[model samples]
Target: MAINSGSDPMRFSASIKVVLKDGVLDPQGETIGRALKDLGFESIVSASSGRIFRLDIDAETEAQARKIAGEAASKLLANPVIERYEVEMAK
Candidate 1:
């Protein structure tokens, strides 16, 4: 949790990194990387794709912001069995 003080209402931005759980194959990322190589884009050696979500929320406190973001992750952003999520918040 973070605390911010100023005249303006506090704003929190969250960055979420969603990745395939260890042992889960990222075939889509691999396939895209392979395709890029085939098309002569040799600069791309590998691809590990993931999802990112940027959110804007208003909360009286940073703890509340974190709690809300956590609930969102558990309910919608992440697949419990095959995906894991990391959350970062800025104020």
Candidate 2:
């Protein structure tokens, strides 16, 4: 496969947040919430577990960088079945 290195390359950073889709059971999150409650943090309502990925890519524009990062998240970082991912550009 050929790589596209734009003539005017700018480094961009992206953050990918992978989380369980709503209505999906998260055993780890439940455990954490319970633990927090047991630790005397009674005000805690709920907790959920998720994964974050930080990636840096060379692109010509912010849109291109976001597309690359989003593709990576969809194809490898996140499972489409029970999980969803959100991509954001880092400042």
Candidate 3:
């Protein structure tokens, strides 16, 4: 939980990362990997594409905030079939 100085609700920020599941094709990541190799980055064998969503939420506790963010991600941010998502509190 967070302690507020006044009557305002406790607010927290969350970051959600959405990525394609393994065995799923990632064309954008492949393109970037090729481009990096062209630039003499041989050690970079592969790349994965993903989306980061930063959200500010007003809640009573950190757990509640995380739950809200996770719910949002599951409902709209990531596709359950081919994509997976992770939610964490933003520093």
Candidate 4:
């Protein structure tokens, strides 16, 4: 049997962007925005599609946390060929 307890000590949060590179165009975002406008969603001034992830880590130091985050971004989060990452740590 598995317990349903939700208590945990690790805490982390990340804001990730998988945008088109400087020379690339984001057709998906543009298309979505246009669709929204067509649907009478005038309140949406602008739209950009991206991903956000929340993680829980065991790192006790900022350096360790950054290292872990960098690994995650490189491995799964951002496409290295067309994207870059910026990591910020909570104090």
Q: Which candidate comes out best when scored by TM-score?
A: 2
Give the runs in model 1 whose Cα sits over 4 Å from its true position. Answer: 1-9
Task: Give the better candidate number (1 or 3) by TM-score.
Answer: 3
**The CA-based lDDT of model 2 is what?**
0.95
Model 1: per-residue Cα lDDT over 1-91, one tens digit each: 4565553656788877888988799999999999999999999888888898887877777777878888898899999899999888975
* RMSD to the hidden true structure, all candidates: 4.8, 3.6, 3.8, 7.9
- Model 2, range 6-38, lDDT digits (tens) per residue? 467999999999999999999999999999999
lDDT (Cα atoms) of all candidates against the true structure = 0.84, 0.95, 0.92, 0.69
Q: What are the per-residue Cα lDDT tens digits for candidate 4 across 1-91? A: 4474454435555444455566556777789999999999999986667665655566545577777887897899888887776666655
TM-score of each: 0.78, 0.91, 0.87, 0.66
Better TM-score candidate (2, 4): 2
C-alpha positional error of residue 45 in candidate 2 after TM-score superposition, expressed in Å = 1.1
